[model samples]
Target: MDFGLTIDQKSFINEIAEFCSAHCKAIDINDLEKRGADPEAIEQKLAAKSWYGLPFPEEYGGSGRGYLSVGLLIERLAMGGYPYPGRLQITMLNGLNVLKNGSHAQKMDLLPKICRGERTMSISVTEPNAGSNIASLQTAATPKDDGWVINGQKLYSSGAVGERNIIMVAARTDFSVKAHKGLTLFLVPSTRPGLKFTRLEAMGRNIGGLYEVFFDDVWVPNENVLGEVNKGWSAMTKGFNVERAIVSAGYLGFSERIFNHTVTIANERYGRNGDSGKRGAVMSRLAEFATELQAAKLLTYQALRLADREKLSIEAVCQCKVYGSELAKRLGDFCAEVAGGIGYRMDSLAQWYYRETRIVTVGGGSSQIMRNVAAAQLGLK
Candidate 1:
């Protein structure tokens, strides 16, 4: 019933905010090809402070802070405009996936390094052909002598380009069984032979290094298999509930920053024109966004609450993901509209947000798929 954070939690959020203040500036990239604040360096700094383990258990060198704390951590980082916000979210969830599905030796070897920031990870699910339809994936892994040869193309595998990165790739291992049952998950090292990462130079994704990971007959030993072969559907979807809950919070936070900036600029610019009628109407429009933002916050927080109890509801996760991502998308356009010319500049965060929010809606699950899932969960076809 309470909608408040404890004193300790509030202070912890403040500490995270302060810790990130130095790295919280808008990305700076010169025409000379130099960019600001290496994403890896910032990640390592966060790791040194044990932040990458914000939601992990302590036995694996994590802080054991739980999912709700991680949601807050992600939101704060995104609010600060930290460039690697998406990467950190996936990094944390990838570790959680390994913990949930990896073998004991795999866990012992990887978890410590992951939590310590010596290594990073990403999940390669949505292939070019498989966006929302998991059953439609065509990527295949064939059994060879003592290992498996993987050959597939994955789209939108965020953060898969880093040197120490390992990607959890989903591939079909059998064709005779049901589509979901025939799939397997593998932890493929980013630097492994036959794996190529081509940066997708689309708008607003440079910060996350969104890439299409191509596997040209990559080989992985049996030990690299995550969970059981022909049973990867569960392992693949294990992180989505928490991802919707936590990553959606980041969307909310980024939306909040963009919303706040728009209001400031709108008020200042509109006030100067001395048109009280126009200014009042604009403020009312902003009020609508604010109300929707509150709704998003409630849904996201509820999802986080359920995750902490390990009772995450499919409906709750879908609601948060759909509403939060849509809000960001709509809010970005509105913010740009209200800010007018000033919002278009590259130095400003508004333009980047304008591009990024459009892509967020389709990342975890598309808004349409989210709605369908929520309706189905409620016994609706």
Candidate 2:
């Protein structure tokens, strides 16, 4: 099998890199100090380029690019030290999954807007009580004449604060069945009367607002139910496979960016204490990071390949998510050490990179949970 990208893929990479270079040439130390980008401006900028929907189908007004192209786009954008690309990744890609699984009416209503950047969508899965144990979710959906009344809260919902829609909300439509079996999915409007979004403060990805959302009697119409009642758990699990795959791709890009910066700085930072020995140490550490980054890239690319092949890649997804996220964390730590005192400065992107990488280990699924999945795949307990 060939590992190198084809000419078309190379052209796609070039296009993404050109866009990143044009927009991200001027890095604002002030923005780093502020810890947030102007969301409105960022949205408009990305929308103009159709970056938000690059991975969606053409019918949805997207660029109609595949995941490989999408991954390259995200990597370049994230290397800019702004989380704008991540916000797009969360909103647009997850929204596409909804299009794939949702009713035809649902797709027609939302997909065009999502692709046009007139709207954004986020996934609502993790709740205050159900972080790792997705099947243990307790959000309930009681039947009404025209719809279902939803009541529960979701936590750590990325980009939900100002998003237009979100999918993957699990509600128990049949309590008699097992927890996973009883759950259903819906596309709930974030601006509905019974929905409330609470912003969460965080160390990184500050520009992409994380939120905790409450759904109190949030009425979701029968037309908005994703797939079928009591069958949504499987759909949601499948979506998770997609989510983990792309999220790992984004962080892998970030890891490469941070590692590159650390190497460039280590080679040039002239100091009294920075002897040849220190320089050699930094180079050796960077070599390790490079090796790990290559491992992460291989895993992530393999997962993408599995996804494109329509294979059961749930196990590969877990492995990529776990390994890529951990490698990102390690790269951040090593970068800090290599950069010495300046790395700890709040004004530096290195500090922010470290913070961002820390979130990866916990999000999607914890490293421990990932390991359990990997072990179970191996026929272990």
Q: Write the per-residue lDDT of candidate 1 for residues 1-381, one digit (tens) a residue.
A: 345777877888898788767765534532111221246567677887888777767888888887888888887777776653556777888888898899999989888888888888888988877878887798899999789999989987777876888899999999898888899999999989999888777766666577898899999999999999988998878777887788888987888777887888787878857588878888899999889988988888889989999999898899889888889899889887876787788766567668777788887788888888888888886
Candidate 2 local Cα displacement, residue 253, angstroms: 0.3
Best by TM-score: 1
TM-scores, each model vs. reference = 0.93, 0.91
Which residue runs does candidate 2 get wrong by more than 4 Å?
25-39, 163-168, 270-274
**CA lDDT, candidate 2, residue 120:** 76
Model 2 Cα shift for residue 33 (angstroms): 9.0
Positional deviation of residue 268's Cα in model 2 after best superposition, in angstroms:
3.1
lDDT of 1 at 145: 78
lDDT of 2 by residue, 146-230 (tens): 9999999888776665545555577778889888899888877777779887777777655556678888899978987888999
**Residue 102 displacement (Å), model 2:** 0.5
